[model samples]
Target: MRISFSEWTKSGSPWVWLNAGAVAISIIMVVGLLALIAVRGLGHFWPADVIQADYEENGRQRTIIGELVEREMVPAPQLRGAGIEVPEGVEAMARDLIKVGNRDFGSADFIWAMDHFITHTQRPAMLFAAERLEWGNFYGYLREVKEAGQSVGRHTGYEKTQEYLTLWAEFQQRIDRVLDIREQILSIEKKDIGSINYEIERLRLKERSLDLEQSTDTAAYAKIEARRSELNAEYEQLQQRLTDLYQQINRDTFVAEIADGREVEIAVAKIVRAFLPNDMGLAAKIIHYAEKVWEFLSDEPREANTEGGIFPAIFGTVMMVILMSVLVTPFGVIAAVYLREYAKQGFITRLIRIAVNNLAGVPSIVYGVFGLGFFVYFLGGHIDDLFFPEAKPSPTFGTGGLMWASITLALLTVPVVIVATEEGLARIPRAVREGSLALGATKFETLWKVVLPMASPAMMTGVILAIARAAGEVAPLMLVGVVKLAPSLPLDTNYPYLHLDQKFMHLGFHIYDVGFQSPNVEAARPLVYATALLLVVVIALLNFSAIAIRNHLREKYKALEM
Candidate 1:
């Protein structure tokens, strides 16, 4: 207790405290970052109250209708630089960014106003925000509903209008009908007609194959023609149905009056949803939030990936990682087994081990370039030449796709697996191996049944680490398989259920594309955080599953180690 400061330092307690403090700080920083991401990402779905405000600008009061997005203090110099008139005594002025959702009015959807100039600001109960398919968002009052150019229902003041007889009610019914028909159109085009199109392509390829073979397959040609004729007939029938549906969906329109007193007639079909945020109750708001979150998780992104869901990206990320794991595990394990159990320990063996360890430290983009050059062009081109001669000129495997991406990642991560497995194999006591062999078990049997099973935990650890690294990788994926938007998912109900040749979307690439490449930065900011958070969660889930298996294996082999 009476130890001197020098003695205390010698006792290592100071160093321990230093380490503990550093660990605590690191944990705190990590938690804070995650919390920030969660808050920003999750808050986007909330039904924010829309304000109807009047602002004095250049001695004129103009009506502004939108949601208050943010508030900030701006120095007087900066404000003056922007040509804004600030009061003489003010060193700084407060500015508010308002989400004035009227992109159709030929100005930015977001506008900034000085707090001192904003005079009247109120959440108007009748002001509705319309979520549209094309024009981002529109904030206005529903003036009237029309069916075939005939006035159907007009909005009377809230108290006077019956619940079922309001223009909003008619708008809702027509929109619901439009949405239902839209679903039908999507199903026919994506599934039924998609299959027909796929078949047609296959037939074309088959005809090409016959031509290349120089075979007089007139019967085959006739059959292909008949099939094409049948498909054409079916397509024409579906085309008529699609035409009728489009007409019906477009028949209903609504007139909405903007803050500037201009009424725009919007086709009901263009609207995705409309809501009066101020009028929504707690339960209704919760439901709306849940629906939005679900849409974000399940729907395909639109609007340059600034709006809609990220299902394809999620699917691609998980699919590629799984495929990589499948490929890397066996090859890595075999290489590890050979090095650890069979290979003679020499200078060359040491060199190979050193090489592997160095490989892990190489830049991921280097792997991407190598994969593009070798796997896509060299290996894939050969495969196409041999197996897909009919599909000439069009690169199938000879392109950046799911297969090449997976293979590239597998090659990139295999070294980690090899090192972990070799270490695990080396940890097995020589007595245990000799004991198995003495009991009449062959070397392979002893290695398989005893050593490999015990090493499973370590192998799982390697795989988990690989997943953690590979999931967040965007650079290599861009050069290999990842794209801004994939027209079709790599997976489908086609002949080859898993189309390894197809380009895909990934959450990592999605974050990059949305965060930086989006045309609308204000709209895409929240989505970037949300997608990043989701990617973290996905990797965590994958690691957790691997960890669970590792734990089970460790437990099973606990007694053996003892």
Candidate 2:
């Protein structure tokens, strides 16, 4: 029998259990989602055994070599919809999604086949997988090693696996050297050359400015031209060095036999990693997994961001959040102080507070449009005309970039900060302010010295909330600064160090790009999970830092707060 409402209220057990159950369910849901993401995303790094299957397709018997990525049961109707015949009385058909990765040799890297059609399947110990710089992975049997188009060693049959492993060690050494040289060349081109180009542009602008002012400074032009000549000379030397490095890197190559018996010779420089997954021990597999994770974290994304790392996106996200917090904090705190301490309590103040609370609920996309129109086009165009007249016809600050993006987010999150800070100021004991005033302190002095310190913990809470919100923002950033791929970071070794006008990548946009816009869906799916997990972790870390600072401030002002 159900208990009476009055008795249940008196007991309080029902309400207590209800609240506990809600909390437990929430915790379970969050943990379960994280686990699902971790399993799917992190598993991509681990080595899986290579399977060789003999199957009949379109009345032809063929051998397929690849790794089994997934297995699923499909309804008979679904298979029939795709023009595949299903036998009578069969409810479902088992299918396998195999990663038969040789994109350069075929149209797609992943293949789906009906499991029932397979004649046989075996885990071959000799099958090899080579991760490359372009066109994804190549799974095959090792054929031969070559240098300058001359064969050094050849492998065939089951015995070839041991021979290939020996040569693979040598290839790894060559690959390491090539990667180092490539990195050096990239540094010279992007950093050194980029800096020179920037300086040249600055000089051009300066010369134009001088001409506009009608300055008769021959020595200034002479100095600028001399510096340009010096930079040009250095650039030429770097170009020669790059040429030599490229030639050296392209000297080695290797041949591999695909399942159909076609031999393809791939340049050693193009290979990122080569391994026999079927033969790897547990310890070796662990090392490989660690290496893959590091590459995902540190390397520049390739193959439409489905392959390699997301360092640029991670950097942009953190940088933008920091800029937003810097911009929003002071403005929010000052406005809050003015309203809570200095303002005359009236209808106008109440209206403003109401407007602010409403602003918090405004659609983020609307803010993005406002930012683009006002900050990017109108105000930015005016600033460009006034300050950067020498670079006319092309917009610098007149375009969507890091500064405007940060400013947009600042405006979006400032309402939260203001509301929180106002509440904090209201919580300061009236005795503290009166005590300061009695000691000959002015109103301003009392508020700054006595009231603000006591309210700082609450201010930190507001900032923490702002950071949590701003870091996950994608829509506004897309209209302002976020791009699918940014060639250079906003902050770099260029003049002024931080280029506020530069476009940047963000993790949120990257996830959207790889998950939806990528050409390879199966390959990008795991990356989406990985990137999503990473975004969560990044937000958590940022919040934790703010929370730590908040805790310290709260402790320091505990007595004052009381």
Candidate 3:
């Protein structure tokens, strides 16, 4: 059927199609971005075959060993400008990025090599990649195993000799032993010794409080001293035990020959994991991949957050969002109820609404500055002087921490809750309120039972939006509390389990640090994507919980709306 353009416009067919196309394109772009991030991030955990190659550079030849990270064609002119001797008239050059993991020995963790100058590339089944505690990765061939500075056995790669297999078994056994010892040491330091220190600090503060009061309390002084003495005795024992564990952990050593034929002796305790990628079967690879992913999720980050897992960041992000919701809900609901229902319709009420709507549009960083000045400096300073005078000059509450960060985000997002709640209240049919009042219900009773219940879903909708924004925000958190690394979690087994004044890590800040602040750009790039995807997952989870609650409320109140 032939149709005029004017008729199509009148029918709204063109606009409808245009809107549908726009929505489809947006969905596709978002899914593509997430897929790209997932591939790049998740692929980092998969073990790749380590390549050993010979290359000639500046009239010198050397063996280069590494995992092939990326290969690309570069403009020959660009290479020449960088002082590389590219052949004339060559429009493009094939270049490869190799991650040579012996960071302590090499000047750089990654090196760029031209394919033309490279020869004799092979992925030897015996070549192993060692993930270390200090350096990033070490690629080499295991020459021998040693114990107590004496040779125990020599490595025979791929030969599967009886003695060589036994040697590998011994190495694995030692690795397991070292891992167990590491766990014990960590538990002692973080739990046992940590508790003693916390108690000692508390005792000191108690004594200081007595001094400030000028109390003639000799008995109190004696009790404090007795507790300190007990803590000191326990701490000395833990220290000696820690010293012994360190000695045991450092006892075993192994020699590995690198690409340049230099054999370096590394301690067995230093290895995070050692794997022969080429020799790994599919099942073994899958197991190894799962382990790596788990480590990334559950372990403490090391080497400036480029190498380890991000449990702290994940925990902090979730905790902050939860705390923010707790704070913003009551304040936002009360203000919204008063404005929409109780306040007389006037210019002042109208002006307050305009101000609140304007606040939602304010730049997040501006809120950060306001929080720093008002909450951290002015308000928190007064709190410290009044309550924590014994810990003088240290500025406990007068600092950026979890409490201030949560409060700051709450203030920043309260406008959202207010607007949504007011809109929900407005949508309630005037008849509903009149009907409740007609049934001999008071105004307050009508609002509490009828109006607020129906508006719960809308309040949850505001919370969902708030979480989505607050989870991804980095700038405001930096000023308020988020840090590159937090030594201890804010919530722990201390006397006061929840320490609101402590600084914390956030996934958003972790991404920023790994991407921009890292010394190793290529090594950190994968982590950046992985953390980004994790952040998305976390936000989605939070929103999903709120959504579930919202759906339940909607279902429960469906009849009320009718």
Candidate 4:
């Protein structure tokens, strides 16, 4: 039993050093990652130096101030001054600004200034200018200009409209040309088809001749057969020509139609704008998004709302999480109740505990595959057949959607809840349960009224952890509900409002789509980081809220602990 201190220290040396080194590396890696993300994300919000022409009071000369202007608010007087024709409405508005000490130049003027100032001059105005021009108001002004048949200031609204109109007119002209070419192509196809038909007729005649020649002589029959083969070769050539003509016509028509669509052009324009050398800050982007989020929640849904807004994803994620929590909480708590309160310590109980622990360790993607296979294909297929036989091939319940995703995540997180609940149940002193039983309360009542209430904080902690993990998970949702874009929100004006079978988008998935699937990767990169940061913030907020609630509950129940 007498061990030398030196030998014991030497024996324990490796584990201590290994653990210390591992912790150090982990801290370094975490700190490094935080630093990188912070620098990139926060830097995006920082003001860029914009060269703005300020008429300094001390100097008569128009000196350029290297102050920051929001990339959105710098005035583009130059672009407005371009072509020497200002719209009557814009001129009136500008004139009105002079009377009011230029205080009433709303979003239109601001946007015009922003476009021109950012594009032409090296001088930038104050960053606060970008802050003051609300995107909602700016967009509203655009709509107003459109409605009034008035031009927007600088290079934006009316300019965009003119550009679109000019492009559209050009597109129409191109379409007309393409249509003329298509007519020629169609004529060529018709000629080829007619030629093929004539050849077929000639071949039939040759076949008839061959039949007649067969009765006369073998040589005559052979000549008729050769003539039929020549006609068949001509028919094949005509058919190939017809196919080529059809394909050419289709290609021309498709190009012309795409060129004519304004929405498609705008999307392309946005992609181009993203690539240009303009620094759009994080705060500006977020503020822009906040307005969008507000609009999505408040305003009537438009066609474009079906494309990129976060409303559907936000609604779907919240609904799905709520549903999953509802389904999982009772089952997990009940399981934990039975394990900790009712079941005696035995081989079976130990095995159950081991199984629960093992389940928690399984990869979430494996669970996703299981959900797709077992829940979607096997069990869901059976249910669909039994109840929804009319929709046999494509069962609504069996499809990949929000309901299935919720169920899948619920199953994946059940073990965590169960383990946590069991631990919470164990933590309550035996005296509390015993006292309840002594007070003529039934075991079930004691378990519910005393044990469950006290254990709720722990259970909530587990739920929060589960939620944080589930919210950011892209893989499982990808197999289940997550889509690149969903046409409608899961909750809509439809009957039985919550459509569990609907596919959804998520911030995590948005990041993936913007980063990888977008046509313009360079344009989407900043958006990708912004989306990632948003997701991280959301998860943190959720977790923090849950932690706060747990702490509150703990404080409230502190007296019960003794």
Candidate 5:
């Protein structure tokens, strides 16, 4: 079995290349997945053109190419002239006409028209405007118009025109005056306003003092009262002027009327027709679902979404991670110190090491079950009975919530920190501990001041790993704190705030909810992916921060090792 050197090298060379190729492929696949997620998530934030679809009363479709306009500009006369009949109960015909005609109107006017049209029709009308359409869809569009147009009685073209002309002229003049005043205000130094405010406060105090002395000293009160009167007058005048200026600005900026539904339809249809493809695929489906998720989040709180926003989930995750780290760190370090510094290398130590290793291998869901039974019901229930008998049979503390979740995860991660800390403690040279002991240092002092500092980096590494595992954990949290929806944040402006007893949403649960549990699974598919992507990002961020801290600690202790 004599093999030539050349043949041996050739056989080994292929295995080497094969291993290298496998590594390369694995890296590429992971990187590619991350890049795709980032692109999709970032793309969600970019602005898109709104597509509006307009359907005529006769079922004929017309696309509106321009922005929304006011009904006034698209007056009944103009529409009738354009061959469209003015329907009865069309309150703001002219305003609706303008909205249908002008495509360059602001977002506020556009939303107003869409809402008004939707209200009148009692049918869903799509408004394809920028999502950032300021003034919420409800009040921004409809409320302003209803308030502004209250003055003009219901009338057709001629009478309304006369009223508009009179109001417009007066309003424009007032607006101009206000603009001039604003300029003057802006030009005046900050010091001037401050001085005026200061003087007003001073005069107010003087007036109060004069009032108290009015019955005591007539001449003294008269002088103080006169000075107070002058100051009061100046302050009142300045306040009145500022108030007037603000009112004028509001009036000038106010949109009195909005476009009709037909106009919004037309605009949305046109935009949609241009961008949306006839054929949709997996990616499109995902995007559509993502939009639905966003809509759910942005919508006013409702029972359907259950989960209000992702804020509670994010907060719960952070709090649980922090608590777990705090709980595990000291215990792990102390246990590691005892094992490394004091305990003999005997059967008990070996058995404990084997138990720790086995604990790490246990299924996470099993830990969830254990936590629910032991911590939540047994230990926690007893504590709750003693301290909070009012919440009997379901103690607030014993409830499946953030606190129990953290404790459960802390238990799961203890072995990780213990193992790493023991390894780190072992790495500390025997000479260092021996030298400290020789210097009359107590064993605890030697372990703490000399040994622990050296092991900090490894302990940090363990904590980082624990956090990375805990953050993405869905199984353990499922029995603990994770909820489908939470009305308020875990921490809020309430008595004894930071309610760890409350169940909260998590990104992992959101993915599950959207994918399998949602009533509209079809609508929630893309949302599931988006949420999954977010969870991945959050876990990565936690790991990165831990790694950074570990590196810093490593560097600090590396000098000591030298």
Candidate 6:
């Protein structure tokens, strides 16, 4: 206890304890944040009981059927400010945020009601939560299945549910058929006819080129016209087929009775899912939760991204990071190698190093602006003119897209790689280099055979950091390539499988859009947390993979370091 400060410093135990404490605090903070995110995000998928509560508001009593989404206690002053009269001496008011999801019938899907005003609360076992195509979730009673405006099933009350279940099963079959037909239509329109149009355009461009060269031949023109006629005939056939498919899809309908006893006829094709949550047992609820999670992972977003999944965003984030890694690695390694191994250690080299270090500290948004100007406008415009002249007037590479976004991120992160690599090169023992040289190896050969391999772990470490930063970046991506909803994936079974010119969605941008830019803030909040959790997990996995590789390399080269 009486030890001198100098002695304590020399012992190094205090410093070690401080370092340990810092690491422990950091880990606790990270874990706590992740847990919070998981709780908010993952809970969104669980099946909750739908309560039919008789709520009295403004002296008017009405039945409200919806899921009890959340409960909160608000200050009495705040409630009074909102025109709600709180009792004398009351400090706060209890309120419930209910998701009364008859959006097509009501103007809003969510409502806030005073807890004390809610009475005659009942969890109806047969109340249905229908996820739809257009309006958000629908909470209602199943009236019966209908075909062409005629009822087909028994109107038995909630007790005799087997008839309703049969109708639901039949409705699901129709939905599947409609989905299949829609897929076929999409294939024809975007792929088959699209390819034909592309070919026709190619021919037209070729003819134009030939005319410009004064070599336009009658035979060539006739051949192109024949091909065009064939494409037109095929397109007509597809149009007729699509018309038939549309007619078939719109045939069946299901009638749902809302809380106000209004029967609404909803097309079977429009229903995404219909579930009776209160009737479900533990196993069924678990299964339903799993299905919802799967859909969230595998399906494309709809309804302003408040409904459905975010597969496109996930795919784009991964692909863009991979592209960035591929682009940044070589350039960073080359610059580092030259500066540390070949370039003379002069003021110029030091100045370059300083600039690189400063670049790392530069605001990422500045890089976004630079990328929009230099990469998207200047270089991409040039690429469009040189390579895709046929697609002029509309930008090909002359717009924000995958390649430019990847390159922009690569530029942003290359500094980390350069610094890590330089330090790694500096760490190689002098004797190792001399020994390589003594073996009659040239400087280049020695670097290739010994230095780079040993320094690779550091290179991987830099890449891991770069991936971690680039994957979660939103600002630059938004400016460069990310979109609210990408119509199609960048990779498709087209001429160029990976379409670098195509714009893509990113999870970071999705999170921002869902959390802030959404039209339905309450509905999108849980989604934001879930997406954030997923983004963290994805980055962690990527970093862990890189770390594993780095560890392996370090282990392999441990003897060399000694």
lDDT of each: 0.91, 0.89, 0.92, 0.58, 0.60, 0.89
Q: Which candidate is the best by lDDT?
A: 3
Ranking by lDDT: 3, 1, 2, 6, 5, 4
Q: What is the C-alpha RMSD of each candidate to the true structure, in Å?
A: 1.4, 1.9, 1.4, 20.1, 16.0, 2.3
Count of backbone collisions in candidate 5: 25
Candidate 1 whole-model C-alpha lDDT, 0 to 1: 0.91
Q: For residue 220, what is the lDDT in candidate 2?
A: 93
How accurate locally is residue 291 in candidate 4, as Cα lDDT from 0 to 100?
56
TM for every model, in the order presented, reads: 0.98, 0.96, 0.98, 0.55, 0.58, 0.94
Cα deviation of 492, candidate 6, in Å: 1.0
The TM-score between candidate 6 and the true structure equals: 0.94
Better of 3 and 5 by TM-score: 3
- The lDDT of model 2 is 0.89
Task: In angstroms, give how far residue 392 of model 6 lies from its true place.
Answer: 1.6
Backbone collision count in every prediction? 0, 0, 0, 17, 25, 0
For candidate 2, lDDT tens digit of each residue in 1-562? 8999899889998889999999999999999999999899989988888888998866889888898999999999999899887899999999999999999887688999899889999877778888888999889887777888888777777654567677767666777877887788788889888887888899888888788878889999898889989988988887888899889889888888887779898898888888888889999999999999999888889988989999999999999999999999999999999998888999999999999999999988888999999999998999999999888778989999999999999999999999999999998888888888999999988878888888888898999999999998889988987889899888887779999999999999999999889999999999999999999999999999989998998899898766
| Residue-level error in angstroms, candidate 2, position 207 | 2.7
Better of 1 and 3 by lDDT: 3
| Candidate 4 global TM-score | 0.55
Q: For model 4, how does the per-residue alpha-carbon lDDT over 1-562 read when each residue is reduced to its tens digit?
A: 9878788788898689889999999999977876777565444433333333433222233323223323322123543555333434442222101000011222122222222222234321111111211111100111111112223322223233565444434433434554565556645554555445545554555555456445667676677678767767876876676676555434421111110112111111111011001234666666655654454343322222222335555666667777787788888989998999899999999999999999999999998998899877787788877765554465767778888898999999999999999899889999998999999999999987888889989999788878877777778878877777676667754445677877887777776776777653433454555556667777787778888988988888888987
Give the Cα RMSD of candidate 3.
Answer: 1.4
The TM-score measured for candidate 1 stands at: 0.98
Q: How accurate is candidate 5 locally (lDDT)?
A: 0.60
> If both were scored by TM-score, which would come out higher, candidate 1 or candidate 6?
1
